[model samples]
Target chain A: MVGIDEQDVVARPGGAASPRRVQRVPMGLMIPAAAGLAFLVLPLAGLLIRAPWTTLPRRLTEPGVLTALRLSLQTATTATGVCLVLGVPLAWLLARVEFPGRRLVRALVTVPLVLPPVVGGVALLLAFGRNGLIGRWLDSTFGFTLPFTTAGVVVAEAFVAMPFLVIAVEGALRGADIRYEEAAATLGSDRWTTFIRVTLPLVAPGIAAGALLCWARALGEFGATITFAGNFPGRTQTMPLAVYLALETDLQAAIVLSLILLIVSVAILALLRDRWLTAP
Target chain B: MIEGMRRPGPVVDAHIVVDRGTFRLDIRLRIESGEVVGLLGPNGAGKTTALRALAGLQPLTAGHVTLAGGDVDRPERRTWTPAERRPIGVVFQDYLLFPHLTAQDNVAFGPRRHGVDRRSARQLAADWLERVGLADRARLKPRQLSGGQAQRVALARALAVHPELLLLDEPLAALDARTRLDTRAALHRHLAEHPGASLLVTHDPLDALVLADRLVIVEAGHVVQEGDAATITAQPRTDYVARLVGLNLYRGTADGQTVRVGPDLALAVDDPLHGDAFVAFPPSAVALHSSRPHGSPRNTWPATITGLQRNGDNLRVQLAGPIGVAADVTPAAAANLELAPGQPVWVAVKATQTRAYPADVQPSAMTRDAR
Candidate 1:
């Protein structure tokens, strides 16, 4: 088949550079793919080219820089931990259950995936803020407030990023061969045991991929963190917020902060991806 | 109180009653321990449905399934054990082995799920692998194993559970000819050693004949015939079962010695019968000649050779004339007669050789037929 296609290409005018070969690629397919590739790669390339290489060491070692970086790492990791605990079961339910309004429920889970991060922060505030529904009751009853705190930052990041994990893991669950679960059942394993031993192990790669996606998305989240947790230095000022703050006063500092986040997220994703995602 | 009776072996006493659309399955069977029962049927003949019902994979619409005196399903009492809880093992047609696990781990799964510790479960799986003669291939995953080897691993995995009843659904159907022969021999040995009542569901007659002690022919979800191997082969109840037993069967009305088989053929049988009846004679019992033979065989008619093929060493000539039938003769005999498609020939069926029975046996007569 390869030889035949190559021969056909050779027979055509202009040989391999023939327009007919490229014409087979539909405009519908080419346009969107070109746009998507540019959208993903251009910003990364822009960051790398504009990074403050001479001031990199000084800016990276700044006291506030370390504090914001540490806080960002801590919050993102904690958010990912929360997602793994709650998102996996929710994903399994969405993928496997056949109840009424399941499609609506699935759409609701992915609402955060498509929603603007600021809107998600507002929604979270309305539900869990100081004067909001549960927040108001908690403030009156226990003198507790979930806004403008590091824990609040974690909650905001988790709310925005958990959908990525859930959707990815749910897709994996949907594609997985459910016969293995049935086979496990026939082997005398109950529903919970089969889910833990057979179903979970089979979809571990998917869970890892999703967790990485969630962590990266959370690390870069700005709107929700600044709105819900209120960007106080070293408290709610995650990497993206710090970069945004530096954007107004000093463009070079903004580029440096963006470069730091870019480097950290890319390095972490690459290392973990090789360790878990690419493996069997 | 003093007991004077001795205990018999475990027998699978099951009453399967299910309603699946237009087809209804109503079958009661008692498969003796250490005996292999073949549930033989056509594609839509509900053979697998019966097996699933017994295995607790499908719930019964009514009736009860008791394995060795333990009730597995009773719709009346709303007592139904799930498939995993039932002490029954199944070798599905595709094997359904866990592709991610090694052969040993796949076999160990059942034992591990049954609460055996890791070390003991692995040991049990190793023993089963050794028994199946695949101990050296234990570390190989299911994708690496051959078709026959995968089937054996599936069987070993099922047997590792030490089930009270074993159900094999087309265990050898997935294998090629040579593989099937070897797998059949291995399966026969394993089933012989297994002290549990086993039900082997297959449409292949050779698999039933070779691996099962009793033959139960189901048609459209009902047991058409159930007896020992010889009884089923000798006295097939339905035309489908008759074909499975390699008999050319025709349903006709019998009047004295002459039975009008088709529009042109009236075969004279030795068995006296009246009203509706069935006539059966094996292909080997039929003799084909170029001309009418001067023999004592009263059933002789002209036929056209419609098709011819080799059955074993003999040539099976499919004749179409007064009645459609297949006659097996030596290749030399066929050559001597110059047999070919569209050739004219005289067919003879011996009177004493033909067996005629009622179209449907009475319930009382079934007991006598069992003998």
Candidate 2:
């Protein structure tokens, strides 16, 4: 290293022109990179060009479109809230505490992330639908059944989306310096206080990012929401369900709803990326 | 073993014994109120473990920790108080200042945890910040502060709790040399003002001598020696402690002025000590000769250079002979003699330069005579 620095200085004294830049992009890398970009952008371009732009405003303001959009926004937000309350603590337990079968528990938490969405919906129905496992008791005791209700949509969305939040928050918690919590402990802060005041603040950025990802995933939920909630016009139908149903008979309306959801998701992702996450 | 322990009424009394599969640390200590005890040792000597046990962070396998007359932990009785409930504060080696909190808020964290209201906690934190000479930097985050500034903030945060016992783990280890000098001086003043029992864990001899009122030298897993700084430097009991104090030390049986350090090696000392004893002298006291000189010093021995490295302005050579010793020689002399590893040389130390004392737990006359 010293020799290289000395050579750099000697070369500078001789006034040698700056070394030529190596602006090389290997064919091996460029080909795959271009292929990946094209694969991702082609469908989006198709959606834009095939969109019924002339009738977009009229179609978007339809009662069905407005109701589905409102329901999607509300359900996704509520699902995210439920995930935050339950998943944050679960993530902390996985990250901070030592217990038997911890590896198995972590794998179990991530199972939903990889599980088929329709399978998750079927599982949710078996667990919470009338005459199903917990749903049988819930219905008999309180006359409550989750299937085909707005609450059922939220349950389906949360079941599928919670893994994202848990995984992100758990990664953040594991990366955090545990010594800060020890420092807090030495300063008379109890375990609960330390977790709230020090650990949570230290991982706040991770929590926010996880929450955003979870909300996005929930907003786009279609397989689980449709299977479990049985898409009803205003009560349980979300934007994705409406788009899918419109696709069979009204392709133009389907395109308008898809475009609206796409625009909203892109805007949110762009705004949050600039404000919270670093750009690649 | 250390003297002056089990004093009438100590603020902190701990017997820490931790057993990791391969290593076990058993250390006992008693620190009185208003006294700063420096836990000085080499790496992995269990100094930090002892400190952590005292602070209630590490639980002892079979020992007790008592602070300010309260038995906080006694594992035998299954009694334990967690770290948060202890009346103690710790300044971690790297400061471990909460990066998300401002200087004032960091200090206020302790006060708030102790049940002080928000306004009062901030007020107390501001006062401590002022005392640490960081009043104007209260709003700055830890990363925004310089190393010295961050260390002071950590100190203020620890002190804001008014802990009865303060534990500092290599507090000045992270600062640069110049910053360390200033911070050590400031730390000395703050420690002097603290009325609580303070235990400072550091490997730096200068920090120990300057900040601690008493020094405890630990080696491996136990306390080898503990005394005032002057006494410790004058007579180090172990090689690790000797190195920390920058001295050449050896244990031997002494007859009059001659001490037999090994089967084939004995050195003439100025002290008239008998029985088991220790002889110590500075590296500079060793002189090297290419060829044996006339009227040789009785302490002379034929040695081969084992290693050579620059220590300050002089070259420090490690020699292997009947007794291994370190000798410092001027670079000019080294170059003239072509001193290198494996080179044969004669080493000498005058009788007047070597001091011998009893190698036992007797700290009475030996300590006074050495001074």
Candidate 3:
């Protein structure tokens, strides 16, 4: 019942003495914060500074490099599209509904976010590989094997990236006002109509941001793509796969590939960020 | 009653009965075409629940809801209409305008969903915007509109569908005082023109008196009183309703025009004949005198001021004595008498102005069942 001002001790004690000595500095807070900031930026800075300069154009213009980039864009875009179709509804269920195992369901959705991409790829293979449980039946009944194909690359990327969209969209759905839905209902609109007309528009910004995150994650996916789809030129090979393969033979080529990926991603993100902020 | 209401218009005949935990909502109401009934109640009094049930958002534990002569909800037959299919419109307490859509688009949304073509829907939306006097603001998003303007747009959205029934939930509660007054007058005019059966749920007594043909007062999910404002205000059956109507009410034994209140206090009235009767009057009816008056028509008593609150330009002084009552007096008068909490004063009411009636005016069976 007491007001906000009465509860703030810091605001009440305005006469506290200022630190006058260097020894009074608190390293417990400052040291870890600075170290954490550097730890994240240093690796990115290292990539930019160490990239190859000589023969860079020849490396970039190589048919194999262009093929990998094309494959990467195609698979990542497909993965992002799949995520949008499934993740939005899943996020809605998580944010709005109360069902048995809801908590378990939410936790399970985030497993890919926490699990190593290689482990996720292994799990997918176990579930969908030829001779696997459902995979064997699919192969026998439909001859639709999924592994070692471009489709497999998309599946792996989507698996590793979907959690980003689900988590972000769900948070936004929860934060958005639910009264608007009720209002829509009162205005003679049904649940689905309310969602399409009101809920989706209100949460468009969050969904766009989530989509960008999913796309970026899909674009950079390496371990899952390699483990599930393997490395094949013009088929399953993507930019990350090309970078990894080059690392084995030519570290300089790998650095150049890494730099290309970095610059392209930065450009795309900068262009899309404004659109995301202004979404519906 | 069912067969008689076959006209192509609103004729809502509903007896809504619902039990939420220990609270129960039981009300029988009827609204003919072009009628506006105000459902008035305090918070948690099931006003919203009744409105929701009418809108098919809440299921009734018992009773039936009929709109435009069709059975919307009948628990016995296990029939219920979903909110979407029901030809009813509701204006929510908070105008839930779609934040992304412009005001025109938001108003057009319902019409488009109901199968009106896009261009026509927009045209209808524009027409409704003008009806609510917001034509220039049609292109603005909901966030950009003022609260009153948004509320008007919400009303227009509900009206655009030409629903058989219209429901408004605390329509003015979200507005500032100045906006509320203006909006209330405008809403009154709109409701007057609306041909459908309109149900307005509000806790504000002034809104009920000003805009409704009849008042239905609910408390703790049950209809406590229902009548024209004057009847309910004059003969409130419960203490809650009495307080809302701003009357000091007491029930006791009455011998002729004189009613025995406490052991020592007997209120003298001009009305004759009584036994087990009630006496009711407003705080403004009581007059505070400097001392016990020698007048033959005034029933005076020595009282102590218990509390004081501002009521318009005067101070509403709560007095405690053999017969407790409230009196409104000017601050200057209060200061002249040197009035303060616990200050002794004399209060009186004209014998001719005092009203006394049968205390059994409220049926005990209903009261006991009500509790």
Q: Is candidate 2 or candidate 3 better by lDDT?
A: 2
Candidates, DockQ = 0.51, 0.83, 0.58
Report how far off residue A23 is in candidate 2 (Å): 7.7
Tens digit of lDDT per residue, candidate 3, span B1-371? 01243476447878899987788898877787888999999999999999999998899999999989889899999999888777788899887778888999989988887888999999999999999999999999988999999999999998888877889999999999999999999999999998788999999999888899888888887777777888878877677778888888877788988888888888887888678877887887788877777767457889999999999999999899987788888999888988889988888888777677776655332353342
Tell me the TM-score of candidate 1's A chain: 0.83
User: What are the TM-scores, per candidate, against the unseen true structure?
Assistant: 0.84, 0.92, 0.89
lDDT of each structure?
0.87, 0.91, 0.87
Question: Judged by TM-score relative to the true structure, which candidate is superior, 2 or 3?
Answer: 2
Q: Residue B328 of model 2: what lDDT? A: 90
Each prediction's interface RMSD? 1.5, 0.6, 1.5
lDDT of 1 by residue, B1-371 (tens): 00122136445777788997888998877787788999999998888888888877789999888876678799999998887787778898889898778999999999998889999999999999999999999999999999999999999998999877889999999999999999999999999998788999999999999999988888888777877788778777787988888998888889988788898788899899888888899999899877889969889999899999989999988999878898999988988999999999999999888998777564441343232
lDDT: which is higher, 1 or 3? 1
| Model 3 lDDT per residue over A1-280, tens place | 4677577755654545535434655889989999999999899999977877777888889898889999999999999999999999999999999999999999999999999999988988998899778789889999998899999999999999999999999999998998788767756677888888889988988988899899999999999989999999899999999999999999988898899899978976886767764554
Residues forming the 10-long window of minimal summed lDDT in candidate 2 chain B:
B362-371
